[model samples]
Target: MKVFKVVCICTIYVLMIMGTRPTVSLFAHELGASINHIGLITSLFSIIPLLFAIPLGKKIDHLNSKITLLLGGYLGVLGIVLPGFFPNFLGLYLSQLIAGSAQTVLILSAQDYIGRISTKKNRNQYVSWFSFGVAVGTLAGPLFSGIIADLFSFQITFLILAGIGFISCIIIHLVPNEYPIKSKKSPIPTSKTKSTFVDLLKIPSLRLALLFSALILFAKDIYLTFFPLLGLQFGYSNSTIGLLLAINGIASVIIRFYLAPITNRFGTFNVFIGSMIISCVAYIALPFFPQIVIACIIAFILGIGLGIGQPLSISLTIDNAINGRVAEALGIRLTVNRLTQVITPAIFGILANLIGLIYIFLVSSTVIALGTGIAGHNKNNRKTDVMEDSRVKSI
Candidate 1:
């Protein structure tokens, strides 16, 4: 029941975010903003998270997570509806700022909430279900956004997105508060906060997890921010673009259904590397295929490739975290992801302007390939470290 509730809240949260972000990109384009400008606007969504994810993760360790969730939900609703009223570049930027902060809080609280309630035996399954919620939201959010924006105006679409976020807020309010409020005392010593980050980063497996997460975000951010523009360049309509995005979501949902069993069978490292290779291929294919059917095929392939990696990373981080610091570890993970989210689009935007957008896929694929190499090295180092620790203990 708890896992079910967590899935419900996360699905709704992701639905609002995934739906609104693509619309933001398309809306900015409609308002005469260039691709470069759209990328900056998209990067703005990660600004708050980039700065505060770790601290907020630490904070959630002591507070009532449900309250934090409620705050984020309502704030998200406010952010989503901002552009509906303003409908300009300024409104779009402001919405990203507010909505981004809400995103940081909602995700941190949700992951922490689920982690605290789950045990080692079931953590993978719980995180997988939580991810499943994200997948479902991803599938539905863009489809709804595209259809609504096509049928009505962007402003009306924003209003509807805000309404869905509002519903998520209500469900969050009703989610049973399973986490007990910790004493006001900090879990980690104040002086050790900086060290805590460093300590977590020192773990080879955790480092690999963060890298895997960053690579995933690199693909996701590129696709979400640019695919609409790419589709437009190919003369695809908003509805068609949304349909493609939704198809990607469908692939993610499908893979997540089998994620745990697959991970258990192949091991996380193999699955991680394999899925990334799949994404790299999809990235290479995306710009070359302008046909609707081929594009849909690419989106699904990309979805399956990207979907399995995130939950696997989450479970790895939680599994390896120091006792009572799971949320902070997740915070560290989000910090890396948000940083990727923050930098990639803006840089890709500049690259797009200089080199042309068609080649951005080649650039993204190369980056992913490099990241995969580094993560694989870290995985080997993790094995070495584990063996050495065992040898020392045996001695």
Candidate 2:
């Protein structure tokens, strides 16, 4: 049953991602949108989620997750189908906004469900598996969309994705609800009650985790938003860009499955540090070799680094959450990540227009390196906590 649930959730996620991006710029072009308009559409997708994450998180705490999941999936289907029918810039932006909201709900509900089902001994492994599912979906979405676009039309692609989302909704509806863990009494507030976000801000480990998540996502946004445009600038066709993006997806899937167990063995902190360093190297080297083939290789390497780092960071964040606040904690992490996605691409797009794509990669690499340093500081703090715990137990 758990296996079936995970499969259903993964399928839903894939459909959502497939419908949300990949052909967005092409869609914008078809609608006669300017570059600024294209950037706004993309940024709104991330920004909507950032704004809604906390409120949705609080709602998830008290709502039935199964219902929430079903509603989110249906909303995703609506979001996908509406734009296909309209086929205009306004429709495109509206679809993304709706999709972003659905994404927030689906993700928070799924994380809450996972937190309820897994034990500490195997939680990390299960988290890795969940992340792997997302990786697989993300990997498949672009290729699937690209093929559909080539074989038929972009509108048809959206319709097909919407149909898939509907299927996922049915699948999720069929799966039995796993009841959330109940508390006998109210849990500690962590601190002042007036400011929940501020309460989260007070936890040093959570703060570091949020920062790491934001930086990693910023790097990802740089690649996702600009890479296609960069390919165009270099005279590559849409089909070629699609293939290159597919390569990135394949790299992500392979690394997530292959490196996850090794990360578990070496410690997630070490994996996080090492992956960030490799990602930094990949970004720095990206522009130096501007050949299409070389860029493809670098993109694959970047995907590998991303695949390893993301799941570990998520696991660490959830593990460090104050008791009874898993949804809130994951919400905060998602919020920070979405915020970065909102800000970074817009800034990078402007910089790309002003300077060049090379500088975009350079700036991203420097940011990731700085994040790695922060993550190391977090590692030291964790070690100190363990020592303190041990000393108290000894007494």
Candidate 3:
């Protein structure tokens, strides 16, 4: 129940952040920003997180997470309000960096809070719940922002988002301050072979989970970044573009409610691997459908395809982490996720200028499909181990 409460409060916080996510891209486009400029602004969102996620995770592990939560909340409000006050392209850039950095802390603390409260027995259920809440927030954010941005203006929409973020900050009080589920003491270091990040990289299961999750995120980034531009080219309104984005989120929420059953029937590896394959198809399909309805359909398929990997990644990360530092594992996981967030847009942005916008979706699909192959190999290995262990038990 405490996990539910934390997730509910976080859902509201995430709703504000997700709502604001598209506004930055759309607003910059409105201000005559080129694709490269937009990519720079978007990359700024993850730049700080890529740099600071590990240190921030360490901070959350040692300190009261509520303090971190509060800081993230207030900063979310400040970040939202900044662009409104300045009302320029430059303002949008500054707002994203500030907001993205704040969100990094906010999300990490919320996730760390979840790990602190969850038991191994019920960890998967709670992780799914957290992911479900993220889906809900993601669904609500773009639809609501789209309506407001269209009805009023981007500046007014941002100001309203600021007010909502502040209220979420207030809602943080609802979460109970519980103790860490894992030991808070740091592991004693050994001189013989210092465990480095490379050691973590050596884990086949972790490598599988991290790559699968990050590629899903990368595909979603492409959707969020370029889909609006694609829609606008067809003369769709801001509200329409928002709905297209929301369709993706809506599909994600729908799939997650049934994800447990889905995983049981298909196997976790199959679900993740299958999701990527579907996503690859959907991304390649997006460029051809200029019609809003068609685009929405593609978006829904895209959502369902890409959405499964996230919660599954969380579950797998917990199952696979060698150190039992779920907090640190999550931090490292996030660092990988943010790295994709930072890199893909930058590469695609430059490619858009060099080649064309349509080609980026092809590139996105290729990357996603590549991840599926690697995961498929891991999945086969996992099954073999399970079967062998069962044989040993029978003996």
lDDT values of the candidates?
0.88, 0.75, 0.82
TM-score for each of the candidates: 0.94, 0.90, 0.92
Q: Which is the better candidate, 1 or 2, if ranked by TM-score?
A: 1
Higher-TM-score candidate among 2 and 3? 3
Q: Which ranges of candidate 1 are over 4 A from the true structure?
A: 180-195, 384-395
Q: How close is each model in CA RMSD to the real structure? A: 2.5, 2.8, 2.9
User: Candidate 1 on 63-125: residue-level lDDT in tens?
Assistant: 777899898999999999999999998899999999999988988889889887888888888
Q: Global lDDT for candidate 3?
A: 0.82
CA deviation > 4 Å runs, candidate 2: 183-195, 288-292, 378-395
Expressed as tens digits, the lDDT of each residue in 1-395 for candidate 3 is 78877788778877888887788888988898998778878888888889888767656776676788788888888988988899997788788889988988888888878777777898888989999999888988889999999999999998888887888787787666755454433344335664445545556777788888788889888888877777777788889888988899999999998899999999887788788888999988899888778888998999998778889998887667653366566677888889999998788888888888888889889988877777677778888999999999999
Q: Which stretches of candidate 3 lie over 4 Å from their true place?
A: 181-202, 322-324, 378-395
Q: Could you give candidate 2's per-residue lDDT for residues 1-395 as a string of tens digits?
A: 67447656765666456535767866775677655556677887777888878777766766766888887778878888877898877778888888877877887788777776778887777787888777777777776777778788888888888887777787787766766555323243554444465666677777777877887787777776777666667776666767777777778779876775786589666777777887899989876776888978988998888877777777877787765567778888889888987887667767766777667889888988887887787779888999999999999
TM-score of 2: 0.90
